[model samples]
Target: MTRPIFAATPVNTPVHGLSAFGDLKYPAGFKQFDYANPDAPKGGIIRLQPGDWLFNQNTNTFNTLNTFVRTGSAPPRMELCFDSLMSGSLDEPDTIYGLVAETVTISEDRNSFTFRLRPEARFHDGSRITAEDVAFSYDLLKRDGHPTFQLILAEMAAAEALSDGEFRLTFSGQQSERTILAASTFPILSKKELATKKFDSGHLQPFLGSGPYRVGRFSAGRFIEYERVEDDWARNLPFRNGLYLFDIIRIDSFSDRNAAFEAFKKGETEWRGEFTASVWATEYDFPAVLDGRVIKREFPEDQRPSFYCKAINQRRERFRDLRVRQAIARCFDFEWINRNIFYGLYRRNQSPFESSPYKAEGLPGPEELAILEPLRGKIPEEAFGEAVVQPTTDGTGNDRRNLREAARLMHEAGWTLKDGFLHNEKGERFTVEYLVNDETFLRISPGFIRNLRSIGIDATIRQVDPSQYQLRLIDFEFDMIDVAFSLGATPTRDTLMQFFHSSTANLPGSNNYVGMADEAVDQLVDIAARADNRQDFTIAMKCLDRVLRARLDWIPNWGSANRRVAFWDKFGFREPKPDYGFPVEALWWYDEEKAKAIGK
Candidate 1:
């Protein structure tokens, strides 16, 4: 038989790190990660708004401190309060170094892993973090945690605490080779703290933590602060040196994006990641930016595949037809919006896997064709030809050529203009309501809505509060919604399954926003996940991208390659950030001399 793809140590040997490709960057007993500065100072506050978030996190406002469940909205960066079995490296793609567990040993069959915990590991309450806590955390998450966690841990068969300092996890044979990599990064909660409380309840009280920071003070929907732990247990660990340097990390919440921008302009918040192109180009002329007190610059985005688009709910019967979806996509004029609204700072997005090698390009190569040949009868014929691209429209507000084509396609789909509105043969009007949480979409979506009206479709925008908007999204209550997401540097099978698999199409709170349920796409995802090497993985993913683009369920939008940010000049950081992620609050520290120079 062929050797397993993940080649670990022999049954008795333990290693300091684990990688997907059986290679580790840092050797045993390494001093620190290459991206970390060993002498970075560790004090001062950094005030900012949330730039990115994970499961159950809402950037606008929060009602609960428990972010790991699906019952309520929570603030970002709550992950700082918990420790995991292993932590990931910033510069590498799929390697993880030990954090709470000192070393790990793999079984010969590759179905079991044993992690030995450090003897000195302790929780914030001065209690020892034992193997039992790790076991309890996994079992609880697999049963009562968020839906995302349930989907990821579906293949885990058992979690056993071999001893007070040793833990073992066994997986079913059906799991992918990289499932352990995702499992190792889950936060280990305290069994003693959560055993008496409800795991799924929405509560403002924080859990006991062992990571670098703890929840300090917070209101229900306004602001929350994380105070750095002075006696952090893993402060000097090889994987954690020169990180979490801020004495206090504060995150404020505002219902409106423009209000948050104003806060940054007045120096109430120290850092602001500018997302609106019009504001970035014209509104930086404030006195602070005119002087040297505030620095406005662009930082390179993370090197990963991202999806930014409008997802039409295929669960609704009106959007189930491919021709209708294609016609709706043709109505969007990215060229006009880019020039007139975005100030020519964005590029038209063409593929779901944007900025990655997995995106299907010209015609399918020999390797990709080998994967697509068997699925020919199931997928679209266009998927076998040159990759599908979005239509290029004239910069004129009304592109007669594309608009005429859109009208023809809608007519062919059994939707004809009658009494100034497109109606199907069954007398149902073609209406699309764009659901949003704030007034931000009012400025950018008018052109698209106007184009839709010109084609005799009833297009409208509906604005709701942040909480209600989130509730509607969870219930799949909207006709169309805009979603932007960044996948992991090396996405595994389980990660993609949550976004495209049929099993999660109707699952509540799942990320399959378009309600995709394609058998050929599911087969391609499985083949890609089972790849033993990077070359084979790339081929399978390119084939899958071709099929997804041909379906036209998600209409491509615009994207930028860099992050537009403005910050006060009181922080010091090393240049040339890491490739995979940019956690500014953890990497940058206060410069006292610069703060004095700025009269702060």
Candidate 2:
């Protein structure tokens, strides 16, 4: 007896006024200003100013948002200019508090979830947020949003309004706890306002958002200006209040990071994420830091994800053999790369879920063995029964010992050394082409290539422009490539499945560039997805991690211990959180008096 919930009449809520759903309450320690507080100043603009251009045309839809050329930078910038229904802790996993939603409840069976709308929540145009808007937002994103959006919600059968201010969304399968958290990404949009404007390629002009900031003006290629949304409904939400203290947020787009750094120094921008060692050690001897107009600080990041070595065309003919893949992993000189190019600013990743609760470390404990024993003959014995050895750095620059091991493994895989070249039984030399996007990788990858060459294997490095690199990646037209996969705040087996499963590999723009297809891994991911509770989910995820690590499907790279960033001292930040990245936009604010003292 499942039925789609629906509202019979269009609720004629005033567009420029607020309506009540129920009693409005703010989170603890949240003090609502009377819209007259001098400290909470009314009008000014804040500039985010990113070192990248907006590449995609569709900013209103999620489906094409990932395809946007500014994929690396836009999301962080847009985060300041939008609102999500739910907000997670700046500290721990599974610590989500309500934002746009007043209360979120999951049904006993876990197939359906209901979100009660906040009473006073309103869009930028001042239309009341009702259940209809939430349902419309879900429908639009599910129907026309990016493929990833659709794939993420593949199990969601329908969404409907259950009451005046409550909406229910039902999934086709047993809902994992992660599903509710994932809903936070689906920003709620106002349907009435959207219907008035012509959505060009799904891009909305004068982007109406219900967040702390509202888009004010845009100079196109130069900068997009945003002013604080005074009396913002979700500001007092537990995750936000006392956050976004700036009066304005301006996003200045630039083509180059170096130029952006120079702009920050010249007082054009306020912050920059330091990626180069030269700047890390040398930059910021300015009058700003001495006068407390700017502060230079380094905060350690826990659970920082890895920048991994992704295999392209995994289902393709050449990389089908797990032995060949393992040999390729053994060929890399991780020790050299960590010491030299990265300035030892990274740690080698041991598992896809490294640093998370799901990472399987040490020998299998009895409880873990119980889970493994049941799948004894179904999965590889090395996957369940063996201990994962810690990686070592051979004193020699080439990591000669590891190279020798790689050569031996390749040889055992029917590859033979002939005329100082390793060749398969058919006499084809074991040649691999490595594609990279940056100059740093061009310098770093050669060390590994040299190791391969020393072992009588041929490996070449191909450097391409960023655009060309992305094109090649989407086409799966490379042998080996450097890529990083991002997992959700709460790690799950779905993270592994999305990156290695056979089904995703066949789909375009999916993370499964590895084309991993084993019956056991597939079963583990399915079991993990259907897990009833947190404890069961963790057990399932750890089991999947053990299996994936043993297979060595991806050669792990190093993760940064801290987010290396440089910003004008006029802003302040809280202590770093565990699961979240630098919540810069959430925690940081402009020291207006200090900013005025160093007037532009």
Candidate 3:
């Protein structure tokens, strides 16, 4: 096919739905998400054991309803309370469906975006959603929202309301690549609501929203519930079809996971997403399981890396060199941890982007080479060859080969064992301390600590309260910490900016706690977001994955490829989960008949 030529001042293209990469799955006016069960029943109650943390809140207990603010924890599923200009597709990467906005027009240069809101778009209070609301929301969020929300909207230079229902946002055209997808995904708040409420602090009052459900009832330290509105303004919209099925979604709070697990056995909770591998293997022997009233299931995990690893702080001079980091990494016996501690429930995770299309494996291909060629002198020469792979053990804790290798690497890095202590030329002993918050990590750390001890490193573990743990992490006051995060389903500029960008390296409370300030990484992050096509995106992502893996400051860990869940036999869900989502509570419809049968 021949391509057409464009004028010097390129014209904007109008699209019903927009995608960050290319081509949308659903064209304009598509009835519903193909992944949804259009005819699924909706009603009844679905009780869930409240997750330990709500979104990125610092603590397990929540004190306020305002998630966007920095003072308190957001309620579970608080995001569902308000609709955004566009909603993301669970099954696809970097795609968004129109919600309040009917259609979007992007300038040819990809610097400006205009969204025409649907005239019928209304808030839960029956007020029309206006362009002013969108504009105000942007300003409010950037000025007073949480750091995470601020990071999400960092690229927009300005926003304006042209008329009644048309909103326009212009980009800064700075180094940061801007995308409509980022703007669309943020929750749109009502300008009127903003004037009457305090958004920068904790509140017990109900939050104003424009989505299918609203806060129903809550006992601060005990439980929270969301009740569905039958006449929800956007219930029949293509983007919202077959979602929020439960009439009442109840989340019960427990002191901790152990108490919640006990409640699951006693038939108090309807669903449980189990994370502990040992519990999944050994538990579930109650009468309900024996009588077939309960069921256990596992769904495929998303392709993105779990980011679950031991984050070694390279800001400390001890872990500065790659050789030192690698030597410390070799001491971690992943095979033994999986077999004995995790009950053979996980696979060793390597690259930060492991298990995804972005995962870097084998050698760098031509596209990756294109990205790497410019950084030859800056990066390690070995990075151009086979991707780094962590050491393997024979499911045994005491492996002579790995220990010897660790010792050899340590020696090469100018360290030697002397009188049961690793000492440098200055006679300073090698010592490390792990700051942890959870009991599960407590069980896992002993093994690695033993390995470090064997190599003559004085290692110790300190358990801190959640509040203190959060404070320490914010201050970058730990030698090592266990951390895991996803770069989202689609790796965007925001992901890199928050996690690896040099500007954020020294920023307190930023995700770059590793203190890695490399120009090469920042460039790859920029290139990945600015790619013109999927092929370009893949090339950038692959190269970025390779470069990040080569850093060696991360001790690769393990995660299950499946979501371990067990629930009562009373709900139905769409088969074949989305590539980037596992929407059990959102998509699963309650079956009253099945519940009655189980009761009998």
Ten contiguous residues with the weakest lDDT in model 2: 14-23
- For candidate 2, the per-residue lDDT at 2 reads 20
lDDT, each prediction = 0.88, 0.60, 0.78
Candidate that would win on TM-score? 1
Better of 1 and 3 by lDDT: 1
Residue 293 shift from truth in candidate 3, angstroms: 1.6
TM-score, ranked from best to worst: 1, 3, 2
* C-alpha-based local distance difference test score of model 1: 0.88
**Residue 517, model 2, lDDT:** 74
Ranking by lDDT: 1, 3, 2
Cα lDDT tens digits, model 2, 1-600, are: 321111111122211111011112333344531211224433333444442222232111122222222222122255455565666554444345556776666555546667777778887777788888888778876666544555566667888978768788788864333565565456676778667854333342554678787766665445666667777876655444566676767656554455666677776777666655545656667676666665576666556334355564566665666677777777776677666666666677777765567777667777677777888887667766654543666734577678778888888778899999888777788788888766656656677788778887788898775546655665567787765554654553335456756556765555666667777777778776656455666777778778887776677766655666666655544443334555455456555675566663
Q: Given candidate 1, what's the lDDT at residue 82?
A: 95
RMSD of each: 1.3, 6.9, 3.1
Scored against the true structure, residue 268 in model 3 reaches a CA lDDT of: 80
Off by over 4 Å in 3: 1-13, 50-55, 175-178, 411-419, 423-429
Clashing pairs in 1: none
Candidate number achieving the greatest lDDT relative to the actual structure: 1
